[model samples]
Structures are given as C-alpha cells and as structure tokens.
Target: MSEGNHSSVTEFILTGFPGLHPEYYGLTSAVLFFVYFLTVVGNATVLFLFATNRSLHKPMYYIILNLSVCDILFSTTTLPKIISKYWFHSGAISFTACFIQMYFVHCLGTVNSFILFLMALDRYMAICHPLRYPNVLTNSTILILSISAWTIASALCSRLVIVAYPLPYCASNIINHCYCDHIGITMLACTDRAPYGFPAFLTAMVTLLGPLAFIIFSYICIIVAVSKTAHSQGCLKSLSTCSTQLIIISLYYLPRCFVYLASNVGITFNADVRIVVIMLYSLAPPMINPLIYCLRAKDMRESFLKQFRRITIPKKGQVSALKKS
Candidate 1:
C-alpha cells in the first residue's frame, strides 16, 4: 500500500457481536451494562474489605487484593466502551485511543495471569510446605511479587504496542470484535505484518502458557503432598482450600487456549459464538472472582460480614430515640 493510503485511517469502527439481530442490541447492551456494574461493585467491595480489615493483611489476602485491583482495572479498560458501542451506536475509536485500549486490555490480562500464578504458588507453599510457607512468602516478598507482576506485564506488552503502533493501517479500519486487541488491530495493517505478528503471537503464547505451566505444576505437587498424608480428611480439606483458585485458574486460561487453538487450527466457529466465548473468559472472571473469594474463603466472608454489621448497626442513642418515638 502507498503511504497516502497508510495514513488514511485516523479511527477505527468496532463491529461488536456480529451476526446478531438488530432487536437484540438493547438486550445485549443491558446485559453488558449490568455485568460491568456488578464487576465494579464486587471488586470494590473486596478492595474495601481488604483495606479496612487489618486481620486480613496476610500473604494470601494481599495477593487477593492485587487480583481484585487487576480485575477492576481490566473490566474498566474494556467494558464501558463496548457498552457505549452497543447502546449508543458509537463505535468509532481514534487510532491512538484504540491502541491505548489494546495495550491495557492485554497488559492487565498478562498481570492477572501472573497474579494467578502467584496465588497458586502461595497455595502450594501453604499446603505442601506449611512449615516454611510463612517465611517464604512474607509480606515484603508478596509486595515485591505483586509489583513485579505489573511491571513485567507492562514491559512485555509495551514491546507489542511499540511494534504495532507505527504500522500503517491501510487495509481496513473496522475491528471485527467489540474492542481493539493486538490480533484484531494488527491484522488490519496493510504492511507485511509477519514481522510483528509472529513475535506478538509468540509473546502471547509465552504469556499465557508459562504461568499456566507453573500453576499446573504447583497444583500437582499440592495434590501429591495431600495424598501422601494418608488422611482422607486432610486431603479433602486441602482440595477444598485450593478449589476456588483452581476454578478461577481454569476460568482464566482454558477458554483463551481454546480460542487461540481454534483460530490457529482453521476450526470455524460462528462469529457471534467466538465473541461470546471471548467475553466469557475476559469479563466473567472479574465479575465472579470476588464472589468466589467471599463465598469460598471463610475468612473473607466473616471479615466482610463483620464489616457490614459494623456499618449497619444502629447507635445506642438512635436505639433510645427510636424507642421514645
């Protein structure tokens, strides 16, 4: 493509949930809005509970706090615009804005992957090596690991953004999905994208698979250690402790792997189906994570309830005034 053509596209139009009937737009928008709202509230509740409850300040809860922050940020970065697109029919995004969205969407995702890996390690240590767990995952170490997750994710994603930023988008300006992403945006560049595409793909795979491998290994070790104890009750308790994290890990990684594999292997899925699957993995986890932690982790649930009661209880003066009335 000529330079003139390359410079033509200043913005891109996002085609969200293609192949859907026009009548369903309102319904889809409403659902997305509800999900986004819940995501924000749920994650915020977790953050608030974590912040106010000093007893909750430990390595596990610290990691949960980080994960909560990541979930909130990730949902904020992607959902509102897509909701606008569906609700208001405002789908055009400036070129720079699109790239910014693409960057954060992937960057937060990478951070979440690493956070989950860290959580898995936390669990493994707590379960498999209880004696050394506290020493190994001290508060300082947790802070460093949390910071490192964000830093490493940013550094890795920055390379992709830097490489894709200058590429000329002469081919088309319509992103087939709800939001701008590395693959969707890069495929629109008219230049030979192989140079950028291959590296980005490789980075993505490593980002997705590397921590996943560690998480799996950690869980395997956990299972083995639990099994060797010869106490069924102990084994059950250990599995119960790890179950929530395992559910979240599966939710975070499996659909992503399936989507990537399906796309690369020439397997054809309906466009709408593909987009919904993407949304499930990307959006659902953030919305469900807080619930999982609160419901599955006894400590978190009790702390939240204790805080709620403190907030809602009537003062002694108010109780006397009510009796007088």
Candidate 2:
C-alpha cells in the first residue's frame, strides 16, 4: 500500500487509563466532577477578582487575568471530555472534534507561554526602567501586545487543524488519552510524517522553548539592573517581583519541556506517563499562578483580602440580624 493510499485511520482509541471495573465508575465520576468543578470555580474567582478590584487595575493583575483565561481554556480543552468519557464509559469524540481540540489546546498553550513571557518582560521593564515603565507598557500597549500574542499563537497552530482534518478516518477511533492530544492522535496517522510530526515539533518549539528563553533572559537583565540601584526599597521591590515570576516560570516551563519537547526525542512512550506529564504542564500552572501571585505578592493579597472582607462583612451582619429576628 502506498503511503498516501494507505486507508487513513478514522479515529483513535484514547488510552485514558487502565480499564476500571464497572463498580468503580461511580467513585471515579464523583472525584472527577469535584476536581473539574473546583478548577472552574478557582479560575473564575481569579478572573472576577482581577476585574472588580480597582486596586488591581495594574499591569500585573491584567496579566494574571489573561493567565486565568488561558488556564480555563487549557483545562477545558481536555479535562472536561476526559472526565465525561471515563465517567460515562461512552467517551467517543468525532474526528472533527478531536482536530478542533488539538488546535485550541496548542493555541491557548502557546498564548499562555507568551503571556508569561510578557509578564516577565513587564517586571523587567518596571524595575530596570522605572520612569519609562508606565509609558512603555501602557494599557493601550498591553492590549496591543496581548492581541499580538494570541494572533501569533493562532497563526502558528492553524496548521494542525488544516492538516489533521483532511485525512480519512476509519474504524480505529479509540483515543488513548481521555481527550485529543497531538502526540496521541498523531500516532494514528497513515501518512505518519506530515499530519503530525513536523508541524508539532515546529509549534512546540515556538510555543515552549522560545518563550522560556525570553523569560529567563529578561529576568537575568532585571536582576543585573536591580543590583545597580542604590535605593533599598527599590531593590527589595524589584526582587519581590522577580521572585514571584521566577517561581511561576520555573514551574510552568519545565513540565512543558518534559512533555512536549522531550516527547519529540522519542522517549519511552508510556501513555500513563504522558498523561501525568501533560497534567502537570497543563493543569498545574493555572491552578498555582493565582496562589503564587495572590498569596505571595503583598499588595495583591492585601487588596484581595480587603475586597473580600468589604463584600462579605455586610452580608454576615445581615445574616446575624435575620437569625436574631
């Protein structure tokens, strides 16, 4: 059979997990539901906090909101369907649906990496060039930059949707993962090389390595600049910003390298290992980003807590009054 003429696999069997007995479905379903629910609620609260708190009307929080949005999209790309399939025992998705999932997963993932890079750059500018910082990263400029990030990400990932869609799908449709992943779906391709291999590598590098290098380099410059400053408070403040960003960047970037970049080298292809790595790379960032910034950053914590108290104290008093009456 010629490479092109080889009847293309219509779908893939997702090896989501080792087969669970029917009895455990209830327990697994409950657990997945709770996890997805909490993820949604946590990300939604961060977005809401970023929006309503006027004190948070700064570049840092704006970047955070962007991160939260990306995280929500990131989680949605796979987790929801994965949860459904395992829980229901009928987690079948069409060829079209899988391609769409693969596209957005990469697109949002690329945007997330870019957003983090921008966040690092913003910190660097704020510390290294204080007076000019406001002028340089103005609201208009951030808006333009954020738009540019998304546009570039979309353009980069557009190839996946274009290439994956045209291939003929046949009887083999079981996707090993709960949702459509590039690595998982690409394994099933008849052409074997073009539909999945080259584009995936190119996009992974653009999405993962490029942004990580920028973030690390930006921080290096910021650290040097901060050391030169004579002002104690300025130095401390700069360190604080860099520290928060460093923590998040380290956590997010490493897993991405392990999952996407390392996978390219054709390491041991264990499905379970792949899922765990993907979860860390995908789910952990959004989950911890708000925690890092809100809990660790003093001003953000104070602002978030103060706002929470302001909104909640009145309701508490009203509840007490109602109980007394």
Candidate 3:
C-alpha cells in the first residue's frame, strides 16, 4: 500500500471562492471572522447554559447540548483556515493537516445529523407516544446514544481519509474550494478518482440521507399527532414548539442536499455559488441556533437571565461595603 508520503503534493492551496475578486479579500475575511466569532459565542453560550443549569438535565436538552458542540466543532474545523486564507493570503495547508481537517469536518457534520435525529426522536416520543416517553428516553440512554453517534461518525469519516491519502498526485496541488474536503482533495489525485470518489459519495449519502429520512418521518408523525388534538390552540402550540427546530433543520440540510445532488446529477452551478451555499449551510446553523433557542425556549431564556443577573447584580452586603468604601 502506498503511503501518503509517496504522494507528490506536500501541501495544498485553498481557493476559497474562485470568482472572489482579490480586492474583496479583506471584506470576505472580516465576514468569515465575524461568522466564526458568532458561532463560537452562540454555541458556547448554549454549552454554558447546559453546564450550569441543572433544570436542563433532560433528554431534550441533551440533544441541544450535543448539537451545540457539533456546531462549534464543525465551524472551528472549516472557518479558521478560510478566514486566514482571505485575511493573510495564507492558503497553504500541509497535506497531513488538510486530511485532519477534512476528517473533523465530515465527522462533526455526521454527528450533527445524528444528533438532530435524536432531537426528532425525542419529539416524536413526546408527541406520538407520550405515555412511553418517560420510560423510553432517559438521560443515560441519550448519553449512550450520543456517544455512539460520535463514535460511528468518527469511524466512518476515517475511511475517506484512508482512501484519499495514498493516491499519487503528479503536480496539481490547488484545491478549488474553501476547505480540504474529500471531493476537493481527492479530485487532485493523478490516478482514477472513481475508487475514492464513489465510496466517499456513498458514505456522504448514507450519513446525510439516513438521518434526514428519519427526521422527516418523525416530524410527519409529530404533525399528525398535533393535528389530532381536540383544540386548535393545542395544535398551534405543538407546531410552534417544533417550528424553531424545523427552521434549523432546513437551514442545515436543504442546501447541502441541493448542492450534493446538483453536483452529482449533472445540474450545472457556478463554483463560487456552490462554495457560498456550502458555507451558509455549514456556518449559519451554528451562529443562528443559539438565537433560536433563546427565543423559543422559555426555560433557557429564564436561565440565561438568572445567570446574567447573578453576574451583573451585586449582593446587598457587597453593595453596602462598596458605598462605605
């Protein structure tokens, strides 16, 4: 077996957007940096809320926490290099490091899909089988399932790296995308890309469509259950509770599915447009998810308020001592 060291290319240049004018590099970098910042702060806040608030220790919140972590990790994996590339004219990435980035990028994305599936399953149980939910999905069970998702995703993503690393690269080392993904890097190989490309595509389909199918079915069941409610208000409330998640799910999945299908099905799209769409689905979810949670979840809002007050408001004794001082 030829090792990665045998490959001619030692590094790769990440072409963030093929059509982006050089003059816009600064602006592009600023936008991406802001996105990265928001993603980190927003998702980190969710983690903080989950960590500090005991009231959030439930099956539903477990999924929220897992999703937040996945979002943060995915953003971290894909955003910084692009930001650096545009900001400092530093697009070079070591071959090994590129593969490492690709691994995390795909792994975390898969984990997010599975976590969303869990969220859908939790809602399904709550709405469709309310009586059995208490016995079915406990905190411990969710934890195990979460760990299994991460483990399986990690294992699956490693295959892409394994298959792509050893291919011979004659000369071309430029990757015409924002990151070193399976498609971007493997396409540069001198040999036939079929062996690596097909399996990777198959894996991507399985990882994305598999969970997405369940999520759709679960929501369908949820809608049916909500529709059967006797009062209109009850139906509205049930649908309202799901609206936030549905928005997030659509943001993450729809664009991705479109891009993948468009590329595979001979539907032509501009390369720059494709990259922008990829960035949106990859980064937007992480940045906006916390806002959705804050708006939709009363308990989380209250907890955030409580935490803010605990930090901002002083004790009476301390206030009096400060006045004396």
Candidate topping lDDT: 1
- lDDT by residue for model 1 (50-111), tens: 88889889999999999999999988889899889879989899988998999999999999
| Candidate 2 residue spans exceeding 4 A from truth | 1-11, 19-31, 194-196, 229-237, 319-325
Q: Which ten residues in a row have the lowest lDDT in candidate 1?
A: 1-10
| lDDT per residue (tens digit) for residues 1-325 in model 2 | 2334225553445556645566876786677667666667777877777777787777767777788889888887777776776677667776667878988988998898899888987887887787999888887788888899999989888877676666545435666666676777766655556536877788787778887888878888888998888998988977986886787788878877876666677676676677766666676667677777778767678877988899899999999999999
Ranking by TM-score: 1, 3, 2
User: In candidate 3, what are the lDDT values of residues 1-325, reduced to their tens digit?
Assistant: 4655445777899989999999999999999999999989988998999899999888998899998889888888989999999999999999889999999988998999899889889989988999999999999999999999999999999887887777787678999899888888887888887767777888888888998999999999999889888999989988998988999889888998887777666798788888988988888889999888876888888889998888767776688899999
Q: How does model 2 fare in lDDT? A: 0.75
RMSD of each: 2.0, 3.3, 1.9
The parts of candidate 1 lying over 4 Å away from their true place are 1-5, 315-320
TM-score of 2: 0.87
